[model samples]
Every structure is written in C-alpha cells, then in structure tokens.
Target chain A: MAVRLYAASVLALDDCLLSVMDIPGVLDALVMDHLSGTVMASGGRGEAERSAPALGETLRVTMDALAGATHRGTVRIDDLIVIADDGYHLLHPVEMPFDGPLVIYVRLDLGRANLALARHQLSSITGRLRG
Target chain B: MAAVHTLLTGLAREHATGSLNVPPAGKAYLREGRIAHLECPRTPSVERLLTAHGRAGGYSRAELEFCVAGAVLDAAYFLLPAELPAARPKFRPGECPRPDTRLEFELAWLVGECARRRAQLAQIWSSAELDDVPVTPAARLPGHRATVSALEWEILLSSDRVATPAELADRLGQPAYSVLLAVRRLAAAGLLVAPLMPRRRGRALDRAVPPALPQSDPNVLAAVKRALEELE
Candidate 1:
C-alpha cells in the first residue's frame, strides 16, 4: 500500500500569518510576500525568530536572479517546492487582488509524509483561504 | 465588445473548456467549461508565485517539470468547479494519475479560499472610483490601522487625472480586475472622487489645460496701450 498523508488549511487574517496547522507530520505553515520576502504568518516550532520582512527582501532578490538567468524579461514565481534531507518544503503563491504577490509556505517531515498527498492538501487549503 | 461580464456569464453556462485569450489583456484557462486558472500579463504566473514564497527549491529541471505538471493538474482541479455557481453539479474527472481523494478535497478548498479573497478585494474596489466617476484620489480616510496593499498604495500615489484603473494596471504591471477593485475600494474609503458622467470627448481636456493669461489686467490694459502709443 502507498503511504498516505493528511492535510489542513490555515487562514491568517493578518499579512503573512496564515496557519495551515496540524497536518499529520507537517511541521509548519506560513504566508509570505514575494515582492518583499516578508513572512506574513507562520505556525509550528522554530518559526518564532523568522523575520518576515527580511524574507520578503530575499524573495525579491531571488526573483531578480531567476529572471536574469532565464532572460524572460521579468519573472514572478507561482510556487516553490523543495525536498530536503529532513523535510519537504512547499510554497504556494496566493495572488491577492490588491497586493504584490503573496504565498503560503509549508514544511513537512519527509519520513512521515507523502509528497503527492501533501500537495493535494495544500491546493485545497489555498482554495479555501483565497476563495 | 459584449463586455466581460456578459461574456463570463455566457461561458459559465456553456461549461466550455480550453484557454480563452483576451488578446493583449490576458488569458483564462478553463477545463470542461469552467475557469481553472487565469493569467493576466500584468500579474505573476503560478510558478512565479511558488518560487517567491520559498517553497520548492534545489530541484533539477526534470524534478521541476514533474512538480509543475502535478501543480497544473492540481490547480485545474481546484479552480474549475469553484467558479461555477453552487447550483450546478460538480464534476470530477475519472482518471487521475495519482489517485488521492483527500488531495482532491483539499485542492478544492484552497481554490475557494483564494477566490473568496479575490472577491473581497473586488468588492472593496467596486465601491470606489473605478466605477462611472472621474478617477480622482481621496483627500483622507479613517483608521490608523488602514493598511493599504502595495498595488493600492501605488495607485493612490501615481494616479493623475488622465489614467483610469485599466490604464494604471497596464503601467504598474497588475491585473486590470485587481486594479479596478483597488480603485473601487479607494472610492469607498472616501479616498477617491465619485464617478463622473462621461465627458464630451475633447472638452474635458480643453477645460483641464490652463486658459491663456488675459491679454492684460483691466488697469494694465489701458496703461500698456498708452505706453505703446507713446513709444510709437
């Protein structure tokens, strides 16, 4: 049988604080500003000291670099998914009506979570939060 | 043109699938006749959204492709039916490569949330200057906590008398709908002028330009004439 995973969604009313809390082995979730790299919201351990504003700045730099590399004039990323040794990092961009680009980020345990299942769950979470 | 509102209603009824390109404006991708994803040239793409958030990283080209393929399907699943009125039957495709019922449910939920946010923003804009009124910024608004979105701030600071919401969207690289929403919101917040009646073409411009200075002030006119005669 394939490994199964659970998913949850969090809605942060404030800027970058959406909480997709407690999805089985999933550790944390956050919303960040892509243009400024500011972390709007987050849940779980080790996220206490994360500077949202700093992160937002980093994202802008990253975007600049990516655009330069691709020669695509200008580029904005929709989502970012990363698989590290310890966990999987999923970033989903939520395009707000009146704001610069915004996104939700989630980190999940690799050993205990299913990547496909998590992605599906995140997609739903995004729909609910944005819709 | 029939107008976007009318077109959307027609498309909603037809349940049409495929990408609808609005020429130089943008495109909406639909599946089985429902809007699955929308891409306005002025707004960021889905991939850009993800990378900007710091989620997926350090993947080879193959891995990126694999994830994107899955995301496209995931986005389609979430977006299509959500846009349809609740009265309609929600259809699910039979053959998904990776079958995960829970995943499907979650995707739907996220899409709905995003759509709702979009709607809220739209409501805010609709109440403002983007409507039939002349596009003018407001003098003030209430609340110390009145946080403006980036786009909103840009619109507020950059708007001159000439540019409408759609024109601003093009200049600022934002979605036209989003710009319209922001403009409306500004109006509702009393940060914009009420919509004005359509002007008579060039008349508005003519009025806007400063009239040439009077040939002379009433007193100066006679004095100037006398001085000219003496010089002659």
Candidate 2:
C-alpha cells in the first residue's frame, strides 16, 4: 500500500514556491489557505506566518469594497496589489477543488522589483497552482 | 472530544503508524507518528472531494496536497471537539490508508489549528444553529447593494431554499466548515433570510440582523477615492 501509482498527469506543486523565489527582486512568497488564513508553504525573508491571516483579511475587505463600489453582482478579484513606502505586496487567489480559494502572497523590493514582470510571473505561477 | 486529541497526541509521541478508528465520527491515519489524513462521516473526505469535484483529468500534486491538508484539518475540527458523543476508539497498528503523496501534520499543531478554527467561527457567528438549517437568501437586501465572496455567491446560486449548509457543502464539494462560515457571513450581511423564529427547544434565537453599516465620512471617502485614483 505504500507504493502509490505513478501518474505523469499529476505534476508536483512543491517547486512553485521556489520558482516564485527565483523571480527577480522578490522578497517573499507565501501559499496561504484563505479560508482559515493558514500559511501552507512559504519562503524568503518576510514573516509569512504572521502576515497570512492579515493578508487574508485585507483581501476580504478589498473584495467587499470593490464589490460595493462597483454595485455589480458578485465581483471576483483576480489580482490585488498594495504599494507601501518600501515595497509592493501582491496577492492572487487560486480556487481549489476541495475548499475555499488559496491565496498566493508575494512581497517585492520597491527599488529592485519590476512590477510588470512580477505580475506576469505571479499569473503563470497561479496557473500551475490551480492545476 | 478532547479524548481523541489526547489519544492521537500520545500515539504520535509513541511514533505509532496506523489508523485510529473512532466509530461514527471517522478514523485518523498516522505515519511514523504524524497525522497523514483523517476521514469523518460528518464531513467530506479528501478522496471523495477530489474525485467528485476535482477538474476532469488528473490533479497536480499541489492540488492533491492542498485537498488532503484541507480535508484533514476540516475532519479534525469536527472530530476534536472538547466533548463528543460516546464512542470507543480503536487503534490498529501498521494500518494506513492507500498510498499517495500526502502531507502530514504534527499532532499538536494540527490540534491548535482546529482550535483556532473553532474560535474563528465562534467569533464570526455566535450560534451553530444555522449550520445545519437550509440556507435561505434574504427576500430583500437590507441595503441598496451588498458584496459576497465567490463561495458565498455559489451558495446563493445553489440554494434551493431547502438545502442546509451541510447539504450545500456536499452538493458543492466544499469543506463543510467553509460553507458554514459562508452561510454565517451571509447571515451577518443580511443576505440570508433571518432565522429569528424560536426553535423547538424554546431557545431564543439571536435575531440574524445585519449590523448597521457605519456612515462613510467625507475625509475617508476622499482618501479612498485618492487611493483608487493612485491605483489607476
């Protein structure tokens, strides 16, 4: 029972976080369980454990605000970026099969980061995470 | 009951590998002491959720791992209550669930997380009554408009005005806890029909009224506008 079947279609997401860390000027990367606000995996210099729940709350508030401002029915937030004095915080929500969406949170160096490239990389990473 | 948590903790310390069967609730699978997976009848199992709701074709290891982790935590939340119905727990050594690349959690950390979830839900909604009742969308909005998350929207759409949160969870293949939270949030927002009617037990139900939204100050609105302009 220990030897599970080998299925090529099933790719590993273990490297996704490492890949995010490879992005230029990235300061931190975290995979967060948005529902419970738990940090599933993380890397880099930032305090991911402390920030996951706060970021989750931030995303929730942002979604609510945007929805209210738009007066639209059920708005879905694709990407959220917050600019701080020192750096940038990027959040992307990934839908999961079994539970609420998982959020991928990344912090980037303000002076060294390329915002466009970071966004593109985050999207690509999100695709893999969704898979 | 705390009984399950204590027993699992002891087994983890002993470095036991096998399944701990708590009849009626479910079973816990451990590998080399750490909890690998848990299945509860009251909640959706990872395998069932993955197979039933997973996108067509196979799943990525990340998806598998995420589902496994969520399902385990969810089951633990339901099974680790301080007091549960009376049931004898049996631990069978060297017995594990079918092989797969699964994520394991330390017994202590997992229990703590479950406790956090309980607190989180309690903080959101005071009662568990709505948890099992059919979710009913409010006939009229309390305000001109409201906001809801993707999952909340799903619940609203799937609701037949008859399916309880648990049933909706099963139908949608969502973690029961998540669905429960969404239902409570919807109720808090006045999106769901108020459950103010007294129950058969004669318990006075806390009126599910939406909290009044604070009046927006001009300065705050201006600041928000300025922030939005900057984002654009």
Candidate 3:
C-alpha cells in the first residue's frame, strides 16, 4: 500500500519524527500525534518553521480544557480537519498494534485536494496501517 | 478470607457461570468459571477506561443493569462448560440483539487489560516509601522518542513530586497498573528519578561530626576500638 510507504517514510525521515504520507494532498502532508498534539513531521512548512512540540502542547491543553468544560473526563478525537489560510490540515491518529499508542498525522493543500476524497483516503490509510 | 478465597477458586475451577458480588468491595462476573469481568472500587473499571479511550460512552443506570446481564450471558457462551449439564435452561431476558460481537470482544480485552494494570499498581502501592510518593514529572527523561500516548504524556507531565501510582492513575483516569508499569519502565530507562529515602520521625540532635573514612585503607584502629568495646 502507498500508505505503507508513507508510514515507512514517516518512520524513516530523520527530520520527520513521524509521518503520514499519501493523505488527500489538498495542500501538503502533516504528521501529528493525536495524544500529545506533536507534529512529528511535515511536508510543507512554507515561510514558517512552526514549532511542532509547542503545537502538540497546545493541542493537549486544548483537549484537556475542553474535556474539563464538558465534564467529560476524557477527550476523544472524532476527526480534526481545519481549513487554514495556506491549506487544509487533517489530523488522523493511527492506532498501533502494540502497547504504545501511536498516531499518524497528515496535512494537505485546500486547492489541490478534495475534502471527501481526502477523508476517505485517510480512513483507508488508517485502516490499512492499523491492520 | 480463606473460605471466600476457596469459594472463588472453586467457582473458577468448576467454571461456574454467575456474578459473585463481594458486597461493597465490588463484583466479579465469571463465565464458565473464568473471570470475564471484575469491579474493584480500588481500581478503575473497564467501562471507565473504554469511555476514557472514546471507544464507549457512560451508561445510564438502566443501561448499566442491562449491560451487566448481557455481559454474563455472553461470557457464558465463551466459557461453554466442557460438559453440558443434563438440563440446559432457556435464557429468559428478552433477547437483546446479540451483543455486537466486536464490541463484546473489545470489552473482554479491555477488562483483561484493566485487571493486569490493576495488579501492577497493587505491587507498586505495596512498597512502604513508594506508597504515598507523589508522582512528579522528571525534569529529564533519557529518550529521543518523539511521540507518546495521551496517558503516557500525562504520566510524564503529572508526576508532580507526590502522587503515587494509584493516585496518578485516579488523577489521569487510567488503570493504576498502566501508570505503575510506565513509571517502572521510565525508571529502568533512566527517565525518572528513583524514589528518595523517607525522612526519619525523630528530631535531629547535635553531635560532633566524624572524620571521613579512608577509601583505600580500612580503619584498623577504629575496628580495634569497636571490637574492644564489644568485648568489654
């Protein structure tokens, strides 16, 4: 599976601590950890080298606060799809088979991709990666 | 305690399918005598973990009652007695759609995971000094690994210098044993600091400081004095 290649790329990339390739590349691809909100890798960081760890910390705080506000005691990610000025950002967490829960993240350009197609592709990618 | 333990063990041996309530402590549901579900107030329940993981939602009182009944019957099938009894009784509870097989499997898996996690926590909690040692985040862990699970991250962040494994588990809504395992693993990996010795209870008394002992040579004179004192 091409997605498998992406997974391998993410794991393989020295700069990219984690990767989720072959996402519906509306803009580019992003690799994020759903739990920590850490951006382990990215394909397009045009004009900005955003701090991945900081972003991850922000996501964790946001999730925690949201859970607290809702009195849910836990936060479950349904799907994190956000439209930005440059492109579309999609966060898909891939569940690993082992004990350590790992997730794969992907980002893409809005003009270059279809939301439905990208989501479907990501879903398939996640399923294959998990299996 | 011996009698109760024996009874539970017997149920396990015979593969008796039923719910054994330990009054306020909790309940254990056995299917064909193998433990399928267990609830101990001291440990987080499987339902809580599933809900926390976003796999399931909190159940209403009625829904919980229904689930408890359903769980027992489903476990029975998995625990099908090696030898069928002479009279096979009919299941009375109006057949709810056979519980989603996948969900049932997941539930069982989660239950087992919780039990394992709880046992690990109990071991950590047993240590005297560590019993109340507050979990404090280590300033540094010797790892370059980029990403970890939410619970793992929480364990890293919330080890606030005092919360024990059980306390940390409660705070994070995770199985205590999981936190204990993570802590132990982190400690082994040189990620977390070892627990410090507990403070003495009595007040300090002023005394003349003793000279440092020589590293290379034994204190023959001091040893002779100690031996002479013992003999006298």
Top candidate (lDDT): 2
Cα deviation in Å at residue B9, candidate 3? 4.1
Model 1 per-residue lDDT tens digits across residues A3-122: 111122111222123325546567766655443233334566746226444444455456656666774455667656768785887767765532445566777888888878777776
Better of 1 and 2 by TM-score: 2
Query: What docking tier does model 3 reach?
Result: incorrect
Q: Please, what is the TM-score per model?
A: 0.35, 0.80, 0.36
Cα error, candidate 2, residue A64 (Å): 2.0
Candidate ordering by DockQ (highest first): 2, 1, 3
Q: Best to worst by lDDT, what's the order?
A: 2, 1, 3
Candidate 2 per-residue C-alpha lDDT over B79-136 given as tens digits, one digit per residue, 9 for 90 to 100:
6653433765778998866543445677777777777777778888777767766688
Per-residue lDDT over A8-105 for candidate 2, one digit per residue giving the tens place of the 0 to 100 score: 11224446676777789988777778987766667776575567777899998988787777745446888899999858999988887666688888
Global lDDT scores for all candidate models: 0.46, 0.70, 0.42
How many clashes show up per model?
Answer: 66, 0, 22
| Cα displacement (Å) at residue A117, model 2 | 2.1
Model 2 chain A: worst 10 consecutive residues (lDDT sum):
A1-10
Residue range B1-232, candidate 1, lDDT tens digits: 2333234445556765545544333444544444444444433333433343243233232222222223332333223333323233223333222111111113333344345545555544544325433467755665443445456678887776666564454455344444666676566666777435544554422232222222223344343223222321
Candidate 3 lDDT by residue in tens digits, B1-232: 1323334466667656656554333454545544444554444433333233332332222223222322332222212212222343232222222121111112233333334334544443433233335555556656663334355667878776755655565555454444655665455445556446432321111111212222221343333223222321
